[model samples]
Target: MITNDVLRRVRYALQLNDKKMLEIFASVDNAIDENYLHSIMEKEGEENFVFCRDSLLSLFLDGLINEKRGKKEGSSPVILPAKAILSNNDILRKLRIALNFKEDDMLNALASAEFPVSKSELSALFRKRDHRNYKECGDQLLRNFLNGITERFRGTSGKDA
Candidate 1:
């Protein structure tokens, strides 16, 4: 999924206002004003739409974790791999951390959206690439996960999910 879409969906799922969104960004020391935030939130192909880079998304995810779970004392923020391309796996991992979800909660969230996921299958999604058990997360899985998030937090899934 596009970073903008992820940001928009997450914002809706969490019922965040612009001010809160700004604060979330600020939590990670990335100060974005309302105009920049709006541009990033704009639809693809729209004039003034700013493509969200992987680093920015990474910062936002870190900020989200801090916003929801509180910042850890004496811990430094995680830095994204330099020049790394963000993937669905990265997004999923970040969301999991931000929500502080355990294995069962993730499974339940997916089930809540009628996208039942087996425990082992879900585990594979979080595995390290060279672990032999690792499986790359597909766009469909991320979409379903986000839909499940919507159901879990917003009381409803997307109409077409």
Candidate 2:
């Protein structure tokens, strides 16, 4: 899953405005202006569209966690290790943490998008990479999850449209 897509989906799912999006980024010490944010959100082929790097996406995910779950009382926010590549599993984990979602919530959300998933299958997606049971999440799963989130937050009738 592309970071830009993830960011855009999250923004739409949460109905966050430009100011709120900036605040979320700032919460994790990643200062980004509205113009930059908009550029990043733009369609890939659009003029001025900026490709969002993994570090920025990681920062945004961290910021999202802080925004939703509240920052730890005394400790500094944990910085994601700088990595050149980010996997779909990383994105799924960050989203789960940020939303405080339980296994049941994830199952329900996936099901809401008509993407049936068994408990064991869902658990496999969250397992450590070295674990034998770990399964790589595909783009389709993330896409469904995002669509499910949109339905959950915005309602099935497309009232938010």
Give the per-residue lDDT of model 2 (tens digit) for 1-161.
77887888888888899999999889877889989999999877999899998888888888888889888777555565666677888888999998899999999888998897999999999999999999999999988888887888887622232
- Score every model by TM-score: 0.93, 0.92
Question: In model 1, what lDDT does residue 63 have?
Answer: 92
Q: Candidates' lDDT values, in order?
A: 0.87, 0.85
Residue 23 alpha-carbon offset, candidate 1, angstroms: 0.5
Q: Candidate 1 residues 1-161, lDDT tens each?
A: 88898888888888889999999888887889999999998989999999988888888898999988899998766667788888889899999999999999999888887889899999999998899999999877888888888888888874432
The prediction achieving the highest TM-score against the true structure is 1
Off by over 4 Å in 1: 159-161
User: lDDT for model 1, on a 0 to 1 scale?
Assistant: 0.87
Candidate 2 lDDT = 0.85
| Candidate 1 backbone clash number | 0
